[model samples]
Target: MCKITEELQQIAAELLKEGKVDLVLGYTKGEQEEQSVPCIVTQPEDASKLIFDEYSEKALSKYLLEESFQDKKVAIVLKGCDQRAFKLMQDESRLGREDVYLIGVECPGMKWGEDLSPFCLHCDYRTPAKEDVDSLLTGADIPEAMQGEPLDHEDSFTDINRLEKMSKEERFEFWKRQLNRCKRCYTCRNACPVCTCRVCVFDRENPDYIDRAKDQMAQHQFYHVIRAFHVSDRCVSCGECARVCPEGIPLHLLNQKLLRELDKFYGEYQAGIDEVPTPLSHANADEPDFFGKEGKA
Candidate 1:
């Protein structure tokens, strides 16, 4: 891993030295010894600060949409899932492929102490699969000898299936108990890469659409339910919202349930795999009705 880090730094330095990119987005040593934070290096000499390890958990691609990086050629260090954001942004017309350079890294998974990250456990893509990558940094060949154990969707969906077995009233009660803990911080909304609207519905100044009172159950349910519907088709299951929640809410469960229903009704669909439009992106008379128009409220 140390060797890989050295190679990554060297590449970033070279790109900056050659003027290949105006900015190089990567990770630098965080305040914690074992953690790393997202960094934007503008000078070639500063590229030596870049590092990749078990602590590189944050998705850096989302920063490309920021005003500071806009309209400038940038190079980014990306893992398989992180690279998906580039594809999504390009398809959305918010970014252009030609304006950015990709430094693909083979992810060996990330960890928080002895436990592996939920997103990394469920992921199988070890290397960035994007064809436009300017460079690739390969990890060690030994699978088990590497970092965290890679788990399949079956293992990852255990919580989702448990919720499915409950009766309607029981399910409502379950969510009520969980969401009752919400502080209305909106950390989940801000952390989500797909929640890229210029102005979010929840952040609107008008209180007429939905009440912002944190103590109200109606407000909590409204915030979560509306958010789940908004990202149903676009969610890549990055799990950032759940990770960043201070209240320890399993927010990913909501998105996972929506994904399962979409799969059952319209066949399996994985977002960010290609430029193909999501089901929500189109209107069709032949659409599958998972729930009737008069679904019980």
Candidate 2:
């Protein structure tokens, strides 16, 4: 086991042995040696199965939304990004902060390939807040030399400066080419921690809002655009949606674009850092409407 994985197992075993929490959520080795999957431990002995490493890329926050866990005191392991999702759930009253024990692991950042993920370069929460956590563990921090490096995935938009330099037509063609491969699998939606609707519109028997008949570039664009707008205010930049996409779609770029627009018009905001209302939540009487003129069209 990796050093962090051993430490996590020890901590989880201690927590379970002491009856501090009824369940422990963490990562374990997957079918592939290079991949990891979420595991739930109910017994102290089972805690030994937990592991953590660069391959533990999936966000475990969405598990808390299960009705079975609402009544139980659960202990969960969180990376910097996962903590933001938990925070959003707390802010929205979807989960009670007091009922869960958060074991925050100091993230060095997860890797996509030979380099670090793009989201890690922009992430400010390498560690969770001291007061909110029950226990904090110092795990492997991303190496100093690799700290801000971006994984050079063909679909990477980490160079926001380069993307911004493109003409309107160029940008349109770029996205059109990228989004054209979408199979409408909803893997992105299922992986998102913030997408907590019990009955998502996409899952409805008759999704009137969107064409359910067949997959067209128009429908593909429609699905992604609407989903992007829905989570713009709530996205924590966890990057799970993009990571899970089988088509290699650069979905994080959509979230990043929305975040940039929000920052530009609303004077900067990062969701789930605190309990502040999102830009789309409400408005003050005296607040300037940067979008008012654009709405006329």
Candidate 3:
């Protein structure tokens, strides 16, 4: 067992025994040999069940927002991206800061060796800052063994680049090939922590934007674009969307493209930095226009 896993178990044990939290949200081995699943433990004795490893890819913060967790004093283990989402939720009034305790872990970047999730490759926020968390289970410094050299943000967009480089006819052919594999499973949307609207606009009953034709292209376009737009400001780049995709679509690329755009245009603002406001959520009139509309005038 990893030392970090032991430490996490010990901390969870202490929290549960001391009545510091009503529940502890963490990960344990799933039914499958290679997968890890989120588990909510309420007993101190069950703290031993918690595990942390490369397979622990799901963002635990999503469970915090569910109705089951409401008003309960919860302790959640957060990787850097998960912490960012929690911060964004707090900022947006989706969750109260005082209601939950955060155990910040210094993520040494997740595994990218075998069938890597797209978000993991582009993840910039691997280490959680002590100032941003309730309590630091791990120190501020990343372990030398765990740090992978920073990845070029642009490298995650191979499909996007391929699309851009193709002739218009070829580009249309490429999307036809990819969209043909889409099963309309909605697993990608469901796994996303940021897709928390009570009634998702993609639902057929949505009067605001309903597609009477029910064309597959419209469904695919609407689902992907609307989901991306909703999470543009608050996405933590946790890779959950891609992880849950049965078709193995690189959905994180779309989210990361928006994140890169936000960072480029709005400066380096991460979703969970408690001090900085989300870029789209707050705007400044003095900021330079990246869209070039100002220069034309």
Q: Against the true structure, what is each candidate's TM-score?
A: 0.91, 0.89, 0.85
lDDT agreement of model 1 with the native = 0.81
Task: Name the lDDT value of residue 107 in candidate 1.
Answer: 78
Overlapping backbone residue pairs in candidate 1 total: 0
> Over the full model, what C-alpha lDDT does candidate 2 score relative to the true structure?
0.81
Residue lDDT tens for model 2, 1-297: 556777889999998999999999999889988788898999999988898887787888889989999889999998877888888888878888889999888787777767776667556786788776888877574677445644443334455557779998988888888888788889999999888888887777674666554547787888999888889988888788888899899887888788777777777776778566778887776677656666655
Residue 209 error for model 2, in Å?
A: 2.3
Predicted candidate 3 versus true structure: per-residue lDDT over 1-297, tens digit per residue: 777788889999999999999999999989986877899899999999998777777787778878989979999988888888777777768888889988888775565446554565567777677877777765433434445765676686676777678899996676666555667677887777666777677775746453544347766666677778888877777877777777766677677778877787778766776455678767778888667785655
Clashing pairs in 1: none
Worst 10 residues of 2 by lDDT: 149-158
Q: By TM-score, highest first, what's the ranking?
A: 1, 2, 3
* Per-model lDDT: 0.81, 0.81, 0.75
Tell me which residue pairs clash in candidate 3.
none
The alpha-carbon lDDT assigned to residue 275 of candidate 1 equals: 57
TM-score of 1: 0.91
> What's the lDDT for candidate 3?
0.75
